[model samples]
Target chain A: MRFFRQVWVVAAKDLRAEFRTKEAINASFAFALVILLMFSFAFDLPVETTREISGGLLWIVFAFAGTLVLNRSFARELPNDCLDALIAAPISGAALFLGKALANYVLVLAVELVSLPVFSIFNNVSVTAQFWELMLVLALGTWGLTVIGTIFSALTVNIRLREVMLPMLTYPILVPALMGAMQLTSALVAGKPIGADNEAWLKMLIGFDVVYTAVSLVLVETVLVG
Target chain B: MINKILYVLGIAALAILVWNIYTIARLPEETRQGEVFKIIFFHVPMAITAMICAAVSLVASVLFLLTRNFKFDALAVAVTEVGLAFLAGNLITGSIWGREIWGIWWAWDARLTSALVCWLLYAGYLMLRRAIEEPTQRATFAAVFSIFAFIDVPIVIFSIKWWRTQHPQPVFWAGGSFPPDWTTHFLWNMLAMALLGAVMMSVRLRQEEAQRELDSLRRMAHAL
Candidate 1:
């Protein structure tokens, strides 16, 4: 219980800080919005095709902008040397990682909330009917990303050109999980028959989330101490 | 003595290469798709040997992480170097073979795509090592990254395979059916390449040790 509290405290610290500045939320949201608008311009495809492709495009924007968000994730701690302070504290590295990831998920999910609606408007599709189902996919997908991204951000936090290194270090490993997200989103967008098919994808997302989170929690300590 | 073994391995691997060339070059007139099929022997061996390299690196990385031993890191660096080289050869040869059979330079076949992902993962691993300067920390990070990357391999294969079945069908199968003699050739070539890969790993490990020794000597002289 105390361990969970410690994790929540770490996340609360981030959320409190982020709520004050809204730096990650505002930047990532705008970046995703612009990318969505650009795709709207460059594509010029018909509405049916646009709707079909929009799922992928939506995730791509989120992904590209996510690099920026995750880059600054640890950076927010660096100006005040908060990261080092956190490392010095008696907090479990895994708990710290989970807390940070939780904060990031909240922030990225906020970004998604802002832009996904705009994406629907620009592409002339209504997500209202499938919004809850879509959100479930988004939540699972974002969970996977945040858990992995937090660890990688820590890995590259002290390195030179880490902003670049973070993405290169991140995206390859994220592919399998991201692939799950893309497929499920596609099915949701296309309004396909979804009982077994989407279930499998959801299962994959859960599996990836379970597997990576478990392993990364164990490994995060090594990256954190340094 | 080890150097002599490496020499034998290198020579034997080369001999297999020559024998492969001879067999393909001397195929009978009525043989179907005669010379084009030759690429498979090299392609399969390189891919399998590349996998061996990756597996070795993963194990070494794990050992380094647990033991915090620089020696394991050295072996890891050697294996990664050799593995990445073999993987590059595999990708190129596999693509050419794909071209021969599928008439395109690339196809998003599950196996090929996962191999590409594996290559990217290792490439990133090397880059991660270069970016971190501290000796012990670098090894730790590299080891953790290798483990993370290896865990991803199965997920990649699974996700991509599932995606293939869930999505549109495009005849993504790229390799042609193989003959019995070709399988024999493949096994021999793979054995030879694996032997050479092991040799390269040991040689690189020795070089790493030498360089570390030299580095320590330089530090001592500087201290003086």
Candidate 2:
């Protein structure tokens, strides 16, 4: 009970701070829009080809632009020595990690939400045709990214060149999940029927999210307080 | 004493490797792919040795976290570095084999892609170590990250396999009537590569320990 509250408290703290400043939120959305625009320019493909490949493009944008939100999750805590203070507080490291990850999830999801409409508009695909299934994929995929990106954000928080280090460390480990997400997203965007293969990819995504989140929760104490 | 053991192991590995090379030279060309199939002798063993080194490094990383022993941390680094080299060797040999047999230097096969991803993951691990200054903190963070990385390995292999598999299935031992001596030769090659990996790890471990000592001495000098 208390643990849940603690997680919520930490999450709410980030939300409040981020809302007040709107720094990471605004920047990530802008970056996401820019990426979408560039994709249009980079490939003036036929509408059919765009629909076929837009899933890959959407997640590429999410993965690249999502880093903006994640990179700041822990880095923001550094300026005021807030991370150390958080560690010194009565909160468990797992709670702290979950809190930050939740906040990141919301922030990244917001960027994705906005980007989806723009992506559909630009690429002439109908996200509304498969909104619920698309949301499920986005939520699971983004959660996988947030869990990984958040832990790596903590891991690289104190390192020099952390912005670069965070993605390098995070991306390779993210390959499996990214592949699963990319395949599923591309299919859903193309209005294809979800088959056994898509089912497997979805399960893989769920397994990735659960396993990574559990491992991060268990190891967060050692990583943060050590 | 350790140096003497390593010396013997080094000599044995060299002798076995030389003998294996001679034996491979005399072996009949494959009935199908001709002499190119012989590369499997090196390719398979290097892949096996690299996997073993990665497993050992994973254990060392866990042990370091459990015991807070810097020696385990050094072992983790040493074995991973050596493993990365062997993995690179495996990839290069496999590429050469693929080009000869499949007419392409690369394929998005499950095995090849996962191996490449594994290489990148460990490379990132070493890079993470370089970016940290405090020894304990560095080890802790690396160990934590290594655990996650190792866990991700199976997911990577399975995901890629499920996503799409194009790599050829094992053909050497699939009831094909090959000379029985080839099995012995494979075992000998495996032994040689394992010993070579071990020796390389020991040498790197010593360097890591020496580097730690120098770091501490430098800090002491700064304080004085």
Candidate 3:
């Protein structure tokens, strides 16, 4: 109960602050939109090639923009020494990590809500089939993203060139999530029914989500104190 | 005494490796692999070398985390740097082999993809060390991040391999079959690579100690 409260307190604080500035939300949306616009001209291929890779392009945009959200998540904490103040409080380190990750997840998902529709429109790929499953994939993918993003963001908080460093560190480990989500998204775009055939990839996403989240919970405290 | 023994072994290993090259040259080559097949002898041994170094670094990182000993941190850093060299060797040879065999400069095959990712993880780990200025705090972060980065190895392998098979493509990714004798021949080269890694790591550790000495001396000079 107290743990939950601690988590909520951090999340609530971040959310209240984010609600005021909405900085991450705006930047993430704009980034995704720019990528969508580029997708039209960047690929010299015809419609079929573009269609095949559209899901991948969207996820790439989201992944790239999510970095902005993560960098600012801690970057903002630096100015007023907000992270030190939070640590100085009695809140557990795990709670603080969860709160930050959850806040980033929400920000990524909010960007996704707008980007998905825009992606569908831009690419002319109808996603009416397996809409619910697509959402599930989005949730899991974004969760996986935030889990690593939060931990690495914290790990890199004091580093020089953190903005460049975060994506280099993250995109590598994002293999499972990126692979699983791209596969599922391509299928969803193709209007294939989501069924047991996709079990392994789905399990891949869940397995990574579980392992990364658990490890982050344990290590986030270690990363914070330094 | 240990350093002397390591140097002797390293020199002896180099001699044996020079001899192994003769045997490798005499052995008949595969039709498809042709001359590029020779790259595997270098490729496989160095790949093993990098893996061994990464494992050693991971152990040292854990020791640092447990004991908070700077020595373990130094060992970890040395091993990781040596590992990076071998990893770079592995990537270069693998890509060269890929272009010759796969007709492409790169392939999305599991082994290649995982190795690339593994390289990134450790590169990021090293950058992480540079990010923190305080020695103790940098050690703590490195220890934690090493563990985190190491965990990605198996998962990257598993996921990329599965992702490859699940969705079949036109890519020429069928594994190359080396003769059974090749595995036996790999032992000498593997030993040589390990010896090479050890020599480099020893040199790195010596440099680290010298730097530590310099840092303490500077502090002492300041105090006076």
Candidate 4:
């Protein structure tokens, strides 16, 4: 109970900070929107082709813009020496990590939510029937991204060239999650029936999220302190 | 004494490598693949050797985290660097094989994609090591990242395999009609490559230690 409370407190703190400035959320959403807009020009295909690849394009946008939010998550802690203060606080490192990851999840999911309708409208892909299934994939995929992005964000925050390092470290580890997410999203977007085939990817997404979340929670202390 | 051992090991590796190359060149062509199949002599051994290096590095990373000792960190980096090189070799050889056999420079086969992704993962690992200036912090961060990276490997393999796999099933040891001597030849090549990898690891580990010593000396001088 106490641990959960601590996690919420840490998460709420990040949320409050983000909302006050709105820098990360606004920038991320705009970046995502811009990427979506630009991808239309680059591909400039008929509706069929656009619908075929939009799942991959959406993930690409999420991935690129999500990095912006994750990078800011820890970088913000540096200016005020808030990271050290956070460490000195009574909270456990796991709580701190989970909190940041939770905050990132909410932020990235919000960007995805706003971007999805725009994506559907722009691409002419009707997702009405698959809306709920798409949401399930979106939530799972975003969690996987945040758990990894948040941890790698913390890992690279103190390193030189962190802007470059964060994505480099985060993306390759993200390949499975990204692959699973892209596959499921594309299937749902194509209006394919959800079946055992999709189950494997869902399982992969859940497994990827669980394994990394547990591992990150355990190792966040070593990463932050030692 | 260790240098002497390494010297002998290097000599043995060279002698075995020469013999292996000679034998590989003279070996009979596969009934189906003919000459192009010969690449597997170099390809399979390096692939196996790189996998061993990856396993060793993962163990070293875990050990470093547990012991908080820099030696394991050094071992992890050394093995990963050597492993990366071997993996690169394996990929190149496989590409050459594919170009001739599959008639494409590359295929999106599960094994091929996973290997490429694995290469990128370790490349990222080395890049992470370079970005950190403090020795202990560098090692700690690298080790933690390595553990995470290593854990991702199976999921990578599984995910790709689940998605789609067109890479031909293993015929090397699956009681394929290759003559009995083929196993012997493969084992000898494996031994040669393993020894070469060990020697390279020894040299890299020593370099890492010397570099650490130099770093500490510089820090002390700055302090004074």
- Could you give candidate 1's per-residue lDDT for residues B2-105 as a string of tens digits? 88988887888778777877876665432655566666667767866887777888899888888887899999889988988998998898677667667788
Residue B9 of model 4, lDDT score: 97
TM-score on alpha carbons, each prediction? 0.92, 0.96, 0.91, 0.96
How is the predicted docking of candidate 3 categorized under the CAPRI scheme? medium
User: Judged by DockQ cut-offs, is candidate 2 incorrect, acceptable, medium or high?
Assistant: high
lDDT digits (tens) for residues A1-226 of candidate 3: 9999989888888888988998888887898899888986677566566667766987898898888888888777988788799888898889999998888898889888888888777766667677888889899999999999999888788877788878877888887689788878877777775677777778888988999899889878788885
- Which stretches of candidate 3 lie above 4 Å from their native place? A44-47, A194-198, B1-3, B156-182
Rank ordering of all candidates by DockQ, starting from the highest: 4, 2, 1, 3
Q: For each candidate, what's the DockQ? A: 0.63, 0.81, 0.59, 0.82
- What is the per-residue lDDT of model 3 for residues B1-224, given as tens digits with 9 covering 90 to 100? 96787788778878888988888888887786687778778887787788888888889988887788888988999999999899999889878887887777787755676787888889888887887778888898888888877876665445445654321232223563656677667777888788889888988988887887898899899999
True contacts kept of 2: 0.87
- Those runs of model 1 whose alpha carbons end farther than 4 Å from true positions after fitting are A197-200, B27-34, B155-181
Ranking by lDDT: 2, 4, 3, 1
Model 4 spans with C-alpha error above 4 angstroms: B156-163, B173-178
Interface RMSD for each predicted structure? 1.5, 1.1, 1.7, 1.0
**CAPRI quality of model 1:** medium
Worst 10 residues of 4 chain B by lDDT: B155-164
**lDDT of model 1 at position B42:** 72
RMSD of 2: 1.8
Candidate number that wins on TM-score, 2 or 4: 4
Model 1 deviation from the true structure expressed as Cα RMSD, one decimal place: 3.3
